[model samples]
Each structure stands twice: as C-alpha cells, then as structure tokens.
Target chain A: MDKVTEEELIGRSIKGDRRAQKSIYDALSPKMFSLCLRYTGDRAVAEDILQDGFITLFGRLDSYAGKGSFEGWARKIFVNTALMYLRKTDALKLSGDIEDARSLDNGEPPPGQQIGYKELLKMITSLEPSSRTVFNMHVIEGYSHKEIADSLGITEATSRSKLQRARLKLQDMIRKRN
Target chain B: MEDFENRFDLEVRSLMENAEEDVPSRIWDGVSSALDRKKAPVPAAVWWKRAAFAVAAAAAAAAAVFLVPRSTPDNTPTPGAPMVRTEVPVTAAPALLSEAVPSRPIIVAAAPAPAPAVVAAETAPQEMPSPETTETTVTKKDTKDQGQTAKVPLSFNKALFNKESRPKDIGRISISAGGNLQSNGSPAKMLTGFRYARAKAPAKAGITEVSESTYGMTLSAGIGVRYNFNPKWSIGTGVTYSLLSRSFTATYYDTSSPDLSVTGKTDNFQHYIGIPLNVYYNVISRNAIKFYVWGGGSVEKGVANKFILHDSSRDIRLTERIPGVQWSAGGGLGVEFAVAPNFGIYLDPGWRYYFNCAQPNSIRTQQPFTMNFEIGIRAGF
Candidate 1:
C-alpha cells in the first residue's frame, strides 16, 4: 500500500473509506478515550461515549471544511458526546441553569498547595451530582453561563447562581480534606 | 464578572491541564476492540466523479421515466423541499452540467443553494416529498466531495491505467487518527522498558511495586502529498499531532527500606505538528498483498526527553527537560482491496524508532529505548 500522509488519511476517512476509518480510529483512540473518561468518570461509560462519538465523527466528517484545527473539531465531538451521555444518564439537573454558589465566609488553612490536581478532581467528583455537574461544565469545561443555559435549557442567571453554589460546595469539600 | 472569572479560570485551567485521571484498565481493552473492529460502511462513498457520472445518468433516467406534467396544486405537495444538486465544473465537458445537474431546484433556479453542499445531508429533513430525493443527495455528496476526502492510494500502476497522460497530482492527503495499546503482554519489556530501568522512581515505593500504566491515546490530524518518482517509488511529507500521556506506578525504595506503593506517572503529551519528509521503497505487489519501507525525520514541539519527579507526597512536580531533534525511520506491510479506480483501502502495519531522545551520559540510555507503532489506511487520488 502507498505510505499515506495525514491529510490523505483524514481525507480518506472523510471520504468513507472503511480502512481510512479504522486508520483514524487507531490514530485518535487514546486521547479521545481519555477525554470521554474524564467527562464520564467511568471507563465503560467512557467507551460507550467514545464509540458513539466516532460514529458521529464518521457520519458528519463531511462537514469538516479544513477550517479550524481538526483536533479542535474532534475534541468538540468527544466532549459533546460525553455531555450527551451524561444528559441521558442524569436528566441533566445542571440543565436547570446554575453557575455559582453564594459565598460563605469560610476561613482558610495553611496553604502549600496541599492538594494535587488529581486529588482535587476526586474531591470535585464527590460533590452532589447537581453541584459537580455545574462546577464541571462551567469551572472545568469553560462553558459560559449563557452557553450552559442553552445546553441545559435553563436561564443564564440560573446558570450563574448555580455555579456560585457549586464553588461554595467545592470550597467546603477542600476544607474538609485539610 | 470577567475579573473574578478570569482569575478562577486561570486556577482551574492549570489544574485541568495537568489533571490525570486514574482510569480503569478495561477502558484500554474497550477502545482497542472498538478500533480493531472492521470499519463501518458509511453508505459506501465510492469514487465520486465516477459515481456521480453514473448516478447523474441514472437520475436523468429516473426523472424522464417518472416525469409527471404540471398537475394540480394538490397533486404537488405545497412548500415541498427543493431538490438541490450543484454543478461540477469540467472544462472538457462544458455542456455536461445541464445533463449532470439541473440548474437548481426545479422551481427555485434563481434561489439560494438549498443548503451548504456539506451540511445539506444530515440536517436535511427526512419527510421530504420523495425517497428518490435521498438518493440524489447521496449521489451528490459522493461526487462533489473529491477535494474533502483525499485518500493516498498506494498503487501507482493503478494510476498508470488512467485515461490521461499527465503525472499523478500530489494533492492527495492521508491522516491517521486513533488507537493505541498499553501493552502487548510484554511483561518483561513493560517492566524494564528503556525509559528508566535503574533510576530511583517516585519518592515512595511499596513491597509489590504496582504498575501505573504505559498508556497513550492521541487525537491527530494532518495532511500530506506524494510525488510519484516512478511507478514504484515516491516521496511524501505531512504534519501530524500525537497527544500521548503514559504512566507507570513504581514503589519507592529510599535506600532499599520498605515504603508503600504509590502511582507515579510521566505524561508526554506532545503536539508533533511537524513535517515528515520520507522516501518509500515499495515491495513489488502480486495482487492484494504488498509492503514498503519508509524513513524520515520529525520537526516537532512538546515532544520531549524528560524525567519528571513526583514528590513523595505527589504534591509537586519537577520537570527535567532534555531536548533534541528526533530522527525517525520505519517500514510497513499491508494489503489493498480495490473498491474503486480512483479509490481503494489498504492496511499497513508500521513500526518506527526514534533516536536522539536517548539520555546523554546516562548508563541506562541504550537499555531504555522508545519507539512508536501504527497501522493506518488511506484512500484517494
């Protein structure tokens, strides 16, 4: 077989060449799988999201006009796929549009950045689904309040308020750890 | 809002960027099986121009055979979906447009392009007046997308049978997207891989020396072109990205005394967005099976030679960057099935090795070598 170039491989994948499809799957599986895992926090669920996302990738590969970065395009697909799965699983309570937790005057402890990023994520995951989801979408995924509102079908103001509450809860969690 | 949010965003962004999840092992097996499975048939997008011509002629036949004259307004569904098909410019055949594609939707000749040719497919409503409409759109999608999906066909002889005398165009692009293996049952290899065989691992170690993971997943997209030097050999180059993060759990041994096992990992998430210039010496093919050898170099960033130390508490990370240009060489073996003259699919199991990332003055350098393996397929002009 001819030694294929990245453009050629992606082009063939877009063209629906079955082998090209597999080639794409092989090339991108690790990162996409990891991304799915991050959103779902479970491997089996992540795999489900990965499979569904790839199909979406192939089905709609035609729309990719070589405009934005292809990685960015694929990243959007995986993240959206995970979010979709999350929605189907949890009626998307965060969908009610909440962003922040009203601030509470919680005192701080001696700080040496005592927590690792992984430990912090674990703590975030422990929060109630409502708060965790909002914190994740806004604070972690970087979605705007209005964008969250559109996605979850809630008011933008509600999204903001929910985010505030999530932050307060997260702060409490961090305090308990200390 | 922007002020506090930006500060908050900065903290979260840094954390997310370094955040590595302790994922279950099954995730690897699941994704691998998915990738290893046979690629799905996407309505079988064949050689578009060829398929288009075939479909265009067939569509003409269907139109002629099924033509119903201007019937009552009730007979023609009101506000029906406009049949959309676009013109394909063929300099040789100026009149082909009228025969191949109608000027526009039968009524809205002067109206807007029904939908962008690309998006018009999925977003297209299914309740349109005719089932034949679906076929027309499918045929159009197949034909008009030549520029979008360029599969680098490996068969130069196939190119020889072409009707034209011009050399093959180098516009074809091939991309490899996903799939990776954490380990291939290479237990000894896994334990003693050339990365760091003798170095003191994380600041903590346990009795059993647990293994974290040697996992890598990537989201890569790049384009390349080939110049057919002859019927057998060609030179090609393109850029690709590799977002790889692999980890391993090691028990720390502070002077051989016992410490509990803690997971320590190294994440080498590199964006290998560089040019790969290569020369291919294709093994002669009999029918379906063929092989080729390729050699090249990578000009990339974020790719590194490093030893990251996660503190005993896993609290802080100190990075030691040993940077250099990585020379790479690899070869391939594969088989191709001819699905269409302008298109075909081939699977090549490829292996590659990288030099120059070997730690200098480190006695264990040669024992801990790193390389990459990939099997990809391409289809195009």
Candidate 2:
C-alpha cells in the first residue's frame, strides 16, 4: 500500500473501522507470526501471542503518532506481547550452569553457509526456551545484553551466557545436519 | 573461532530478517469476534445533542401546559346589574339558619322586589358546600323578614364559595433516596470485552477462562427544591450523590502447561455528584394526593473512581479522576401524598438514560438505561 493509503487505513482502524483493522492485520500478521514463532517454539502458543498482539496493537493504536515506521511500531507490540507471555509462563527461568555452554563449543568451524533457511529456523527453535529467547533478543532483534537482561528480568551475564549456549547448540545442530 | 562466531550470527540474522510465516485464518476470526464484542465508542457531540434535545422537549412541554387557560369558577357579577348592600335574614330555612343564623350585611345585585336575588358578594363560608348541592335554596321569607333587601330567594353557586382553594406557586424542599431496580453487571467486562474475547478463544487451545461477575447495588440520594409555576406545572433542581460498584474474577490457563493458571479478581467503585433539572406536570390532584409526570436532564461529575486488582503475584489499586462531565436525561411518573397541610411524602419511579462520558468503567456506563425508584419527604411553603 502507498503511504497515504496506509495512513488512511491507520486512521480508520483507530476509529474502530473493522475493514480497516482487517486490512492492517492481513498486512502485518505473517511477519508477526514468524516473530512470535521465533520467540515461542510452539505453533499454538505463537498463535495465541499473535492474537493478543493484534488486540494490544488496536487498543494502543492511538498512541502511534506517525513519528516512526508504522511497521516498526507494530513489531514492538508483538514482541512485547510475546515477552509478556514468556514472563507469565516463567519460560525465561534459565537452568544449568553458565560454564556448561563452553563445553559445547568444540572449536568447530561454522556450518551456517550450507544450511537452508528452514533448517536454520528448526535448529534455532530446537534450542532451550530461555536460551532461544536470549539469542533472538540479542542476535536477531539487535538488543544488547543489558536490554535483554532488563527485558527478561535476568542479569546481563546470564543473558550473554544464554546467547552463547544457544549459539553453540545451533552450530552443533547445523554441523550434524551437514 | 571469533570469525566463525561472527559468520554464524550474521548468517542467522540475514536469514531471519524477512522471515514470514502464513498465519492461520482462525486467528483473524478470533480477533474479529473480539472486536465485535467490544463497546463501540460514543462521540461526545452525539450525547450532548441528545441531552439538549431532551431538555428542550421537556421545557416545551412544560410551557405548553402552562400556556393553556385554566377553568376557574366565574365569580364576576352579571354585566349590568348594579351592586347594592343589604341585610338578608336566615330564619326561614333551617339549613340556612344552622349555617348562618345571625344576619349579616352582604352585597347583592339590586333587582325588582320579590325577584330572584343575585348574590354579588358574601362573607367567606367557614365550611364548603357538598358537591351535590350546587345551588343553596333560600326561601323568600328569609329575606322578607329583613324587609331591607329584596324578597327573593338567596341563590348562589356553591363552587364559588368553595372552602378548599387551590394553592399557586407552591414551593417545596425535599430529601430523596433511591436505588437502581436492575443490575448493571460488571463494568470491566463491558468496557474491556475481556470475558467475551476469552470466550471466543480457540476451544482446543483453552487459552482463557473467566469466572462469573458480581455487581454491587447501585444507590443514589439527593436534596431538591421544586417551585410550582401553577397548580399543574412545576420545575425542580437538585444535587445528588451516587455510588456504583462491581467485582469479577478472571482465570487464564496456559496452553503449554494446562495445570498452571493465573487468577485475578477486580473490584471497581465510582462516586458521582450530579445536578439535575426536572419539569413536572401534575396529572391528578385530589384531597391530599397528587400524581405528576416529570422529565429532565442532569450533568454529573465523577468525584472518585477506584479500581483494585488482586492476583497471585500482587495487588494493584488505581484511582483515576475522569475529567469530563457525564450527561443523562429521562422522565418518569411521580405521586405525592400530603401528610399535613404543608408537608407531604412522595414516590418517584422513573427510567433514566446515562450518556457515555470520558469516565472510566462504571455501572452507569455499562448500563446506560436504568429504572430507579425514589422516596422522599417534601415540605411546602
């Protein structure tokens, strides 16, 4: 959609026009679903998060002042909704010792270039829940360790440790697949 | 090793940057159903127009009632008859003698001797005549014995001498208390659509669950003053205080862990102070009873609004002061029973419609239209 049409759609959606809301949802839901899936491995849980994100988006749509990209603004809501779900489920409670991540490194060369996108996503989802969350926040979303820690209510060191463990686990899986 | 780590992170980020997965169609259906259950926003202008229309209609109706001519007994003397003072005897008729035995001077229209007498003016009667006796019969001898007045039967219309007179411009101060006859349920459910949305959640997922809602009794009390412009029409204004409350419990079950659930209970209380202006039309008036129909509008401001939420984790209490005024208009029937000459008690059973305002969730906002009953004592001067 053109910028003008997108702005109009947003205006109408804020006013509770159902067609406008559906249009926005159709445009945003796919990417948002993928984001939810990356944060929550289960398809059913991701679907629940997706529904809640859209609801929160429409509820707080009035706060969007067109200062930033509308897509970015909407993405934040979906991310927050996923995070809220994680917190409520206590999915971010890290287990095991941080030193355990170093043992899995194995000094192996990266096999990322040979892996397909689907295989890579599968490997990422296969990581433990807390580690996967930390990895997604720090690597894919460009959040700093401190930001991830603050968001997940964990220490910065713990966020870094989870990310390292997640990366080692993913590399190990990728090497086995190759 | 560091280069390998950098390459792995870069590859993962690039692959996931534009990742898009097809969303199941049922998620949109759930969202659509949830939006449908949400309360539609009411523009402030529309409610203002409605309230203005109500107040205007009420004023116009009251004006129409006041403008119509009232039927009163014609007490003016016959057009051409000259008024004369004379003494009339009450001895011939026993009823007249018992009523007015002592002859007193009265003004009567002069006519030929022995002609029927026309009473122009007489002393105010102590007792009112019976309805059946429209005209009092005075024998000719009653006047003949005096010889000073015409020897005509003293005839008069009893209604002209009615002892009980209709009061005008009566003022009344009243104190009233009443409650809503119907329950408005929980305002949180009405405002947030939380329960409805949770109900529409996928059954297999079993993502959301809510408990039954409990609502507190809605109550109101006020002190008012009314001024009767005439015997039939009057206007009233008063300050009223209202209290509304509701509570509900909600429990959400996690899809991944069915055994784990979060439960929360919410309680809401709202207090409003209102000023109402009403117009009343008396439909019936008998010995000491009156029936009236009234219509008017009111503007209320929320003085205090509080929401309390209790969950397994923590308790949250929030107080929000809504800035905008709440508008409402309605009409109902009322009856007043006079306990004394100047003191009466009244009952007003009426239906009221509350207009949506900027105020947060409350019973008034949840159920805009409600039936209320009010009882109070009124002192008239």
Candidate 3:
C-alpha cells in the first residue's frame, strides 16, 4: 500500500474500524507469521505470538508517529512479541558451551546440491532454542552482538559464541542432507 | 573461516528475511473477538444522552406532582382551630340543640322573615379546642316557627378535629451497599512521579517494555440518615467506604552477571472513607411505593493506598499514604416500596463524576465518570 492509504488504514484501525483492521491484518499476518515461526520454531507458538503482536500493535497504534516505515515498525512489534514469549518460557537461557560440531561440518555442499528454502528452514528450526534465537537475531534480523546481548539480556561474548555454534550446527545439518 | 561464516549468513538472510506463510483463519476470529471485547463500553456520547433522558424524566415527574390538585376529604377537617359552619334541618334542630347545649338554656332570637336554616360552630384559642369550650349558633326555618334563631354551645371531641395537613415529622436511618460499573476503555493514568520512575528505570537498566494498566471492579457500602421536611422533599447525609483497584505489568532487566529480564505484575488498591450529602424530591407517592429523584456530592479521604508486586522470583508490597480529599457529584432516581408503614426498601441508580484530587494514579483518576446502582432498606421513626 502507498503511504497515504496506509496512514488512512492505520487511522481507521486506531479508531476501531474492524474492516480496516482486517485489511491491515490480511496484509501483514503472513509475513509476521513467518517471522514468528522463525523465532519460535513451533507453528502453534508462532500463531500465539502473531495474535499477541497484532493485539499490541493495535493497542499502541497511537504511538506510531509515522516516523519510519510502517512495515519496519510492525516488524519490530512482532520481533518483540516473539522475544517476550521466549523470555517468558525461559527458552533463551544459554547453557555452557555445546560440543563443537566443527568436525561434522564437511568443507562445503557437493556441486549441484542446492538447499531449498524449506530444507534450510527445517535445519534452522532443528537447532536448540537458545542457538536458534541468537542466530535469528544476529544473522537474519541483522542485529549486532551488543544489540543482541542487550535484547536477550546476555553478554556480547555469549551472543557471539551462540551465533557461531548455531552456524556450525546448520552447516553440519546441510552437509548431512547433501 | 570468518569469510565462510559471513557468506552463509548472507545466504540465510536472503532466504528468510522476506519469508511469508499462510496464516490460519481462526487467528483472525480471535483477533476480531478481542477487539469487540475492548470496544464493549458505552461511548461517552451515549452516556451523556442517557443522563439527559434521566434528568428529563425526573423533571416531568416533578411537574406532574406540582400541577395536579390535591383534594381534602370532608370528614377530615383541615388542621388547626377554625370556625366551622354547617346547615341543620328543622327536623334535626331539636336533637342537635339538646345534645350541644349544656346545662345553660338555649337563647332563641325570633326574626320576621323566613330564611334558610344555618348552624355555625366556633372553636376558641387557635390551638385544639376542648369539648366544653366550643360554641355553636343555630337558625331554624320552620313554617310553624318562621325565622327562629338560637345560640347553642357545642362540644367537639378533640380527637375528631385534630387532623394535620402536612406529613408528620419523619427521620429515617438506612444501610446501603452497591457496586459501580466503570468503563474499561480508559487505562489508569499513572502518577507522574511513578511513570517517571518506570520510564527512567527502563533507560538506566536497559528495560524496554511496560504494559498498559487495567482497572478492576469498584465496591462501596455505607449507612445514612435522612430527614423528611415535608411529603415532597427530604435531605440525607451518609458515611461510606469505597475500594478501588487496578493492575499493570512491567518488564525489568537486571544488568548483573547473569543478565536476565523479569516480568513483574503490580496491583494497586486504594481505600476511601467518605461523607455524602444529598437532597431528594418525591415525584410520586402511592399506597406502598414512592418515587424520588436525588442529587448529591461527597468528599472522600484515602485511608489506605497499597501496591503489591509479583515476579517469578518473589513478591514485594508497599504502602503509602495519600493526602487530599476526593470530591464527587452525582444524581439519580429512586423507587421505594414500603413493606410496612415505617419500613421500606429502595433502589437507586445514578451517575457520578469524580474530580481530580491531586492524589496518586488510580482508576477514579483515569475514568472519573461512572454509573452506580444502590439498594437498601430504610426505617422511619
């Protein structure tokens, strides 16, 4: 949607126009659900987070001062919702270092063996919760180590180590699949 | 190794950042229902219209009461001592004369012209008259004794003539209890200093999120005394106790060795003792029912203000004294059913608005206008 139409939709949604709310929902739910699934790795939990994110979005819609991209602002809400869930479930509790999966990470994928999106998503989701959170925040979401540390309430070193471990695990899973 | 890691991250981001998946339809249903729940409270405009209708209805009732004429019965004479006149027939003149005149002989004055028979009874002393003190004058129009007039002293039973025009002195003592229904659309406005603390804490401790405050139900109970000045109006004053409550959630980040965020929930309760003064106007009073409209104001002092915080690890409680009085004004209609002559049950539904009292944040401060329904029993002596 264009900026003016999007602003009008938001205005109507804030005033509790259900049709406008449904329009915004229909436009944003799929992408937001995908983000939730990437963070949660469970479809049910992802749906829950999606619902909560939309609720929080509508509740605090007035705070959205048309500053940056509306999509970006909405994306942050979904991200925060997912993070809140993970924190509530204690899924972000980082344990001591895991056994290095470096030995299993064979050099590279065989020639002509390309990993598709579903397979890569499966591989990422198969990782442990803490590593998956760190990987999603750092790699996919483009969060720096300090930002991830501050967001997840961990030290920069722990965030970096979790990211490294997650990457090795994904590499191993891809190598095995190939 | 770093270059390889960077390449892998870039490839994953490219695949995942724009990922979209179909959402189940049930999620939309849930969102729709939640929105409806949030929108359940009657809008401010609708409430104002309702209030206007109520006021108009009360005014109409008052007008009806004033415009209708009241008829006094013949047997029940008007109160206070007054000269009463009655026509006596010639056939009954001898019996009335024999009964009314004491030992003194009736003095008869004869007139030449024929006239209608008339008897006038005069009672002395503006106060109630004794039987012996009342005087009666009798005139007889008989063909045989034309225009015969006689002065006779009459005796009246004090009880038969002592009827009051106004209502008797009535004082009522009542106990009442009720709950207020408040609109949930408005969130409690936090105290400025408390909100500042929360805002500053998040920055200092790297805490990011705080949820909105939600208010709970309010309850009140009280005892009152009302004095009826007349049949149409009464004034009442009472002491009441009220409890108001609300809660919110805040996420706190500990910047220590094992950095972690804790979500804490806080519930605030405020207790108040108040005195209300109201004036009631009776619009309709029939055999067993009385309908009235009352308007009043109250002043409340906060007695206890407490906060309880609960987190995953532990709970913390704090209490602070809030100074200043909360002032509120309201009006409503009441219907009272008298079970006995001196005892009655009443229901009053009213609207009230609380004024800002320079106190800490609370539900009253957030949604100051509310509707109240009270039911009680009153006893009059």
Model 1 scores a C-alpha lDDT of: 0.44
TM-score of 3: 0.52
lDDT of 1 by residue, B145-247 (tens): 4324211111122222223321232333433322322222133453234223222122221211122234333334455655556545667776666443444
TM-score list, all predictions? 0.34, 0.56, 0.52
Q: What tens digits encode model 2's per-residue C-alpha lDDT throughout B235-288?
A: 889888888776654333343532223345656677889999999998865434
TM-score computed on alpha carbons, candidate 1: 0.34
Name the runs in model 1 displaced over 4 angstroms. Answer: A1-6, A16-30, A94-100, A104-114, B1-5, B17-381
In model 1 chain B, the worst 10-residue window by lDDT is B109-118
For each candidate, what's the DockQ? 0.05, 0.22, 0.22
Ranking by TM-score: 2, 3, 1
User: Of the candidates shown, which would achieve the greatest lDDT relative to the real structure?
Assistant: 3
lDDT for A130 (candidate 1): 51
Arrange candidates, best lDDT first. 3, 2, 1
Show what share of the native A-B interface contacts model 3 retains. 0.42
* Per-residue lDDT of model 1, residues A74-115, tens digit only: 766666666555654663565444434555443343221556
